[model samples]
Target: MAGRWTLARGVIHERASALDWAMDSRPRSDSRARECAGLGDGLSPAELSNLTPRAQIAEEWERVRLPESDRKLRVLIVGGAGVAGRNTAASLSKFCPQLQLVIGARNKDKGVQTVSTLGGNSEFVHVDINDFTSLQAAMADSDLVVHAAGPYEYADTKVLEAAIESKTTYVDISDHEGYSRRAKSYMNKAIAAGVPAITNAGANPGVSNLMAATLIHDAQTENRGQPQKLRYNYFTSGSGGTGPGVLSTTFYLLADEAVTYHQGEEKKLKPYSDKRSVSFGEGIGERDVFLLNVPEVASARRVFGVPTIDARFGTAPFFWNWTLLAVMKLLPVEILKDRRIVQFLSKFAYPFIRAVDVISGEKAAIRVDLECSDGYNTSAIFSHQRLAEAAGTATAAFVLAVLEGSTKPGVWYPEEPEGIAVEAREKLLRRAAEGAMEFQITKSFCRRKEKQGMKLGWIN
Candidate 1:
């Protein structure tokens, strides 16, 4: 596939350069080899030594030409300084070469540095998420906007408003559980405004949605009519260059102790209500997990009709979880929000939290275990802290592909179609490989004991 792409590129290059060769009109078989070599023979000693194999190849063949697929993409990535933004930019540059990638940041210098380091044809713009005028100005003449800069706990929907106003597609990696739930309120307006918006494109929210969709699809096909049972034992044990780090989420978990959920009916859960033993691949052995109330699972419940679903997450090392539990029990209710307390945690607890698994050197490793009806049980583990960036990059690739007519414009997610998901994953993996940050996904399933069937239906 890569060789074919290279051959096609060569042909395009040749066609584009044909006009120059025609003007010269000095093409004879004798000059053919020399011209194809591209390196002028009269090079000085310094130039001759610097010549590379790739350069020599460029000199030989006339590149093939095809009608350019107008990926008329002017993608504006908000919060381009962070890890996700940087990864997204890198991926877009590689997979969507014809895209006009723009990275926007409140800090001009940071934006410039991000674009310069990430490479590809990229530009930098100074914009603030909080400031509407700034967002509007930066987003002008853009077809898509990916909002990656947020603790969205503090962000407003002004960015979404701007996107709707500009008639541009919008996607965000929002960690704030509140924002994601409320985002549905604007779906009608967004649809009416003729713009598609995604509230969470990062892990948990992004990948979780796909995982649920895939499971639901499988369940529907396998099961006939019974209650489907599903549970997720998810864990990520590494810090990456982007998105909310382990330490930050730890603070969030500590602060939000009272977790609410739906049973047969809606109810509240004491944080850690359902603790269970879980396991990942080698080096990442068995670990205890706890159910935390997150909007991703909630959205999955509402969006996909997987009647019984539970999501449990925890970092490994039995001692660590025990200590965290102890801290949560002892910490005073009021002190959870204390500035000094958070600062102290940032200074002291975060470093230790991030270093829990230095042996593996993984940015993160996530495992999702599913036990469906009819005794089909499976578990898949993915390791890569760079996945947050891959999510952003994959999103960018999709946006570019949509603009290029490789895909259609509509509200969509990774699991909407297997082909689309595979393409996006390929693009992301290619870019990740270039950066030495590969996103590895492995799946294993077992049909242990055959049992009763289950019924499945789309909730929304």
Candidate 2:
């Protein structure tokens, strides 16, 4: 039997959100039909017939797999024992087995454990992110540095500054607007040191930035239209099966007001407000996403030359989003900003988050919606069954790009043409799409304007 999936935007019924399904099983009884818990929550069927049409990518899984580098570069990954770090390290070893992996962690046991699992040449080094000398020491003799230690909400640029001073190529998974902005400000120093750095290079900020860049580039070069409004909508199930560590990051972001560009001017928007119901292709369906403080919003404004660009993010079991709103209204910003407090909150919420992850099953997707000046809209969508693997693959793509000497000497965002050439964008995305079940980029994905006052807002 076929899988049945239904999505209703802005509504929260976590139990039903996974949807009803049609299945045939060996133990089927004539009186009752079996209900199935869906796997590949984002891409079980991969393509949806009802979705808006686009020229989608079609590549075999290994087609985009990058060649192993013979340079034998050694990469020092700070916080490598953590979830994000481990994922990135796993991908690096998988794609570029020739490169030596240095897993830098404050915890020796965890780092050593992670190193033991990788197939390539790898080792673990002890380093404290807060201690400048320790951080510098870890990357002292390495060819590059990957600052996977994150939450990045209140994180100082100790690692980035150390990277510049040490002249090591740098990449990080930071998604915070403020932290990445400060890192970007170190452009001249990185260039002076003849170092290449890519900040905000995770899944949404990383792969999503490259996706937005590709969309805008194709629009201008191919005479599509003057690219106007760029809206980034991202969806992740439960904690994205990425563990509860991400909770602190999101909770900490509530302290700062989100910023978006408007008509070439900066506009301040309330975090988790400005709700937009977006359809993330097939199985993931439509979700109500709200404005969030993502670095790409501000950085992409400069890189893509767009005045009206903003980012929205929505996560599963819908009440989780509502819970954030509750936290904002009930707690003061100062309390949310406190690292210890947020860490405690994250730890407290882990069991609940873990429960949701079990049902939600780690599915995730990114939809980059671009509204051109021509009034027609073209968009790109990427979906993955596993968020950890996808995030790792995206970050690993950026790491490999920097390793191959593709990025120039400067602290750059993934979307910057100078940092990652438009020509190189496809390859980056190709590698980023490594384990993704479904990914699409089309200059011609269009939607017709619905007659207003008929069935207004998000009905389209």
Inter-residue clash pairs, candidate 2:
none
How big is the positional error of residue 418 in model 2, measured in Å on the Cα after superposition? 2.1
lDDT (tens digit, per residue) of candidate 1 on 205-294? 555555455445544565623325556656555444333433555555566643343443445565655788775444355667887756
Q: Estimate each model's TM-score.
A: 0.70, 0.82
- Give lDDT per model, in order: 0.54, 0.76
The candidate that achieves the highest lDDT relative to the unseen native structure: 2
Q: List the lowest-lDDT window of 10 residues for candidate 2.
A: 17-26
Minimal lDDT window, size 10, model 1: 1-10
Model 2, span 1-460: residue lDDT tens: 3322222111211222122111111122323222322322354243322221122222223322344555667889998999999999988887777678999998899999999999649998999999999988888889889998888877899999999998888998998878888898999898899989998888988898887887676667657678789989999888886855688888987877888889888988888998888988666889989888888888887777787988888888889889888998899998998999999999999888888788878889898978787654556788888888889888888888887667899988888876777677776786787666566543333334644332111113
Model 2 alpha-carbon drift over 4 Å, by segment: 1-71, 443-460
User: Which runs in model 1 stand beyond 4 Å of their true positions?
Assistant: 1-72, 224-227, 238-246, 257-263, 316-320, 337-344, 347-360, 385-460
